[model samples]
Target: MRVIVDHPGWTPASEPRRTVRTENSAWTATAGATLILNRVGEGRDQAPAVDTYSPMDLGGSIPENLRSALEEQGPVQRLRTADLWEALATAIIRQVIRADQARLMYHRFCDAHGAPLPEAGPSAFPRPETVLALDEDDFAGLGMAFKRRPLIAAAGAFIESGTKWAELPADVLVEEVQAVPRIGPWTAGATLADVTGDFSLYPYGDMAVRKWAAHASPDIDWPTDEGTFARWWRSFAATPEQLSALTVLTLALGGPRGQDQPPS
Candidate 1:
């Protein structure tokens, strides 16, 4: 299915791709969109294609819970693009190694493989097989953990099965991804952000985000529960239109090129 992401200002004039997780958190995340979203089953080539997206289906509708206050904070700013599988590799490497180390490893890995890095906000995440086939000892030489070898391999295998990482149902992908070696909720969440364009996840593993939460409330600490974070996200929107608006805002505020804070 072609997925055309619906956001206020962001438009996917470019192809969809995986988004990179950077030390620059302020960057807006771009969602991968396709024609499937606009399909009415009659055929997309037809004039004025199928339209209308429901909140329940998108997981981005307005919030009506006690978290109504969440909307007052701001919208989720995001870019109009994503880098697909490439983002997954970077996210995994980040989890396995320090940011600096991960970046170095990624560059080196890309260089050796001839996938020179892109200057854009994001690029396609490498398939798991490509990374898994690498020499683990090489990363070890960079002081990265050796334990990640299995995780990387697992990711490669997962992608090999025509697994649509970005488009899979969240529950299924989350469960499956967390099962991979060294992968957990955070890693899976990042993968989803790049692949599916589902923005409900706040990418909870960032230390910088944790610190932001700590500062938000003394009672709240890093690694806060999903329930709490969800509630916080709820406030980012008040209506379906508002939710879309926040998606744009959240990405913009997060530092589209500078530093990105966790969705407020």
Candidate 2:
């Protein structure tokens, strides 16, 4: 099975799906699915394709007011990283930087130290242990700041704690991660959403979300409170995180198709 992931910054080896992309390029991991099989010690035996979520899956769950805005956009699909460490590390790298800059650095980091996926052409992002072992001088010219060292330390701590870190509940994960020197709500929330498929976590400090959510749903009254937002989502049996994605897609592509997710 061929896997192609287009989400920028997610490394290849850990990609849950077979596909992966860099800052500006997409690559097919021809043997990615096979690798998943190998990891689980399963022989190739005609496994079924994974069922993915689509906008149509939302159905009546969409709020009435924002439906039109979201309906006009291009294809949007929910994407997840291959693992918790990948999600957490990627979030840390993206903090307070322009996306293009961050993605370019991420590409460089992966290219230099990522593990070889011999069956596929591209390499996977280095594991937390590998990242922790890299010398500070090696990070030179990669556009990383001094703070990246501590970020790696935090990731190492999380990774070394074994299943304990992975098992952290959503709220607890947020609290624990935010305790890291430079990690914040936006980083932690984004990690939980990507790693755990927790769509209820809206990364609160994002400026784009603030602007888009306000513009797309004016009826709710902007800046009312978290409770108001929570209440709004409950009415549609949806989540602020989900609505945030919808709002972003609507703002970005004008609208999404009936069958595609918006801003996932």
For candidate 2, the lDDT comes to: 0.53
lDDT by residue (tens digit), candidate 2, 184-215:
67677777766654445645324544455556
Model 1 TM-score (2 dp): 0.51
C-alpha lDDT of residue 176 in model 1 = 66
Each model's lDDT comes to 0.43, 0.53
Judged by lDDT, which candidate is best? Answer: 2
Task: Write down the RMSD of candidate 2 (Cα, Å).
Answer: 7.5
lDDT of 1 by residue, 84-189 (tens): 3454455565563444445456555544443323345333234456567657675566455553575565656566643464466765776666666666676666
Cα misplacement distance, residue 157 of candidate 2 (Å): 1.0
- Runs with alpha carbons beyond 4 Å of true place in candidate 2: 1-6, 10-65, 211-264
Per-residue error for 193 in candidate 2, Å, reads 0.7
